[model samples]
Target: MMSLYLLNTKNTYTVAALMEIAKELGKEDWDFSQNPCDGNPNWVTPTGNLSQSKNVVICTCAHNDSCHVVNITLMRQDLTGVLPPSLAKLPSIKVINLAFNYLNGTIPNEWASTKLEFISLSGNRLSGSIPTFLSNITTLGYLSLENNLFSGKVPAELGQLKNLYLL
Candidate 1:
C-alpha cells in the first residue's frame, strides 16, 4: 500500500489561489485539512460525473515531486457565482469542467494567459459575447460554451488555435 507521506503538499501560493477560486465560485466544501494532492473525496472524487452535483479538485505530484492542480470538475453544483479568474493562477491546470451549473458571467480575461487544454462550460447562464482573448490560449484544444446566453457571432480569432478540435 502507498504511504500517505508520499503525497506532496500544495505550495502555499497554490493553496491560496485555490481558496480564492473556491470563494469566487461559492464553493464552501473544499476541505483544507488535507493537501490538495491527497486522494480525498473533496480533492479527487470517484468519477468525472458531469451529471451529478459535485466538486472535485485534482492535483499532480509527479513533476518535480511537488503538487500542482491539474484538473477541476465542478458540475451540476448550482454554483451561483462567476467563472473564477483565479483559475489562471494554477499554471498546471489542463482540464476544467464546470458544466450543468447555474453560473453566470463570461470567461475571465485572466484565462487568456493559461495553458489550458479542455474546458466545458455547457448548460450555464453565461452571457456576453465570447471573448476573442480565447484565441490567446494557444494550447487550448477543446472548448464548450453551449447552452449559454452569449450573443454575437463567434470570434474569428478563435481560428488561431491550431490544436482546437471543438469550440
Candidate 2:
C-alpha cells in the first residue's frame, strides 16, 4: 500500500489523525518525523519488553511496502481525555484497547462505520447509554464495556452480532 500512502503523501492525513488522537488522549512523545510503520519505539512498543502489549501501533505492510495500521493498544497509561472522533479516520484500524485510562465521554458516532472488530473501553470514566450503532459494525466480535459509568440496558441489537463471543 506504499502507493496508496505515498500518492501525494496520503499518509500525511493519517499522521495528522494520529496526532489529533494522541493530543486528545493526552499522549506525548510520539515522534511523527519517522515512519510510524517502521516499528520504532517512539511509535511501537518493542516486543518482549516490560511494556510489551501495553502501548503500540501495530501495522501491516503490503508486498509493495505500503503499510496500514491495524491495531492500537494503550492499556493502563493513566491517560486523560475524551475519546476522539479522529480515530475513525484510520481506515484500516480494527482493534483498539484503551482500558484503564481516565478518558470520559461516550463513543463517537463517527466510529459506527469503522471496521473495528475488537474494542475495549472498560475501566474509564465514560458515561451515557451504549450506542446502539455499535451493532452496525458488523465486524465487531469482542467488546469490553465494564467498569465504566454507563447506564441503560445493553442494546438488543448487539445480539445480532453473530460473531460476538465476548462482552
Candidate 3:
C-alpha cells in the first residue's frame, strides 16, 4: 500500500517518516487528511512533541461554514501518552480517527459530552473500565476499543447509545 505523510506545520519531517507516522496510526489518518485536501484543504500541524505528535494533534475547525468543512481523521499517527481531557472541548469535531497508537490510561470521562460521530481507538495500551459517561454521547455512531488493556465487564449502559451502529 502507498504511504501518506502528515506534516508538522513546521514541516520538518521527511515525507517518508511522515508516511511512517501515518501507518503507525492505522492508515486511517492518511485517508482523513486526504479527503479534505481536495476542496477544504484540511491540514494538521504538530503542536507539541514531534516524537509524540498524535497526542497533541488538535482539530482546528473554522468558525464560518465556508471553511468549517473538516473530516477530522488522523487514525494511526503512532501517538503515545494519555488522551488529554481538553480534547472533549472541541464541539465542532465530527470524526476522531485515533485507531492505532501507543495511547495509554483511561478514556477521558468528559468525552461523553462531545459531538463525535465516529470514534476509533483500537490497538492502544488503554486501561481501566470504559467510562460510563460515554453512554450519553448519543451522536456516536462508530466506537472501537478493540485490543486494549481495558478490563472488567463491558458496561451495559453503553447500549444506551441508540445511534451507535458499530462498537
Better of 1 and 3 by lDDT: 1
Per-residue lDDT tens digits for candidate 3, residues 1-167, read 64343334433232343344344333333443342323322345444435433422333433332222224444556667566465454445567766777888888876777888888888889999988888888888999999999999888888988999998
| Candidate 2 deviation (Cα RMSD) | 3.9
Pairs that clash in candidate 2: 1-66, 2-66
Q: How much is 70 displaced in model 1, in angstroms?
A: 0.8
Clashes of each: 0, 2, 3
TM-scores for all predictions: 0.88, 0.90, 0.61
Find the candidate with the highest lDDT and give its number. Answer: 1
Listed per candidate, the RMSD to the true structure in angstroms reads 4.5, 3.9, 10.4
| lDDT of model 2 at position 131 | 96
| TM-score rank order | 2, 1, 3
Consecutive 10-residue window with the lowest summed lDDT within model 3:
61-70
Q: List runs of model 3 lying over 4 Å from the truth.
A: 1-70
Q: What is the lDDT of residue 25 in candidate 3?
A: 35
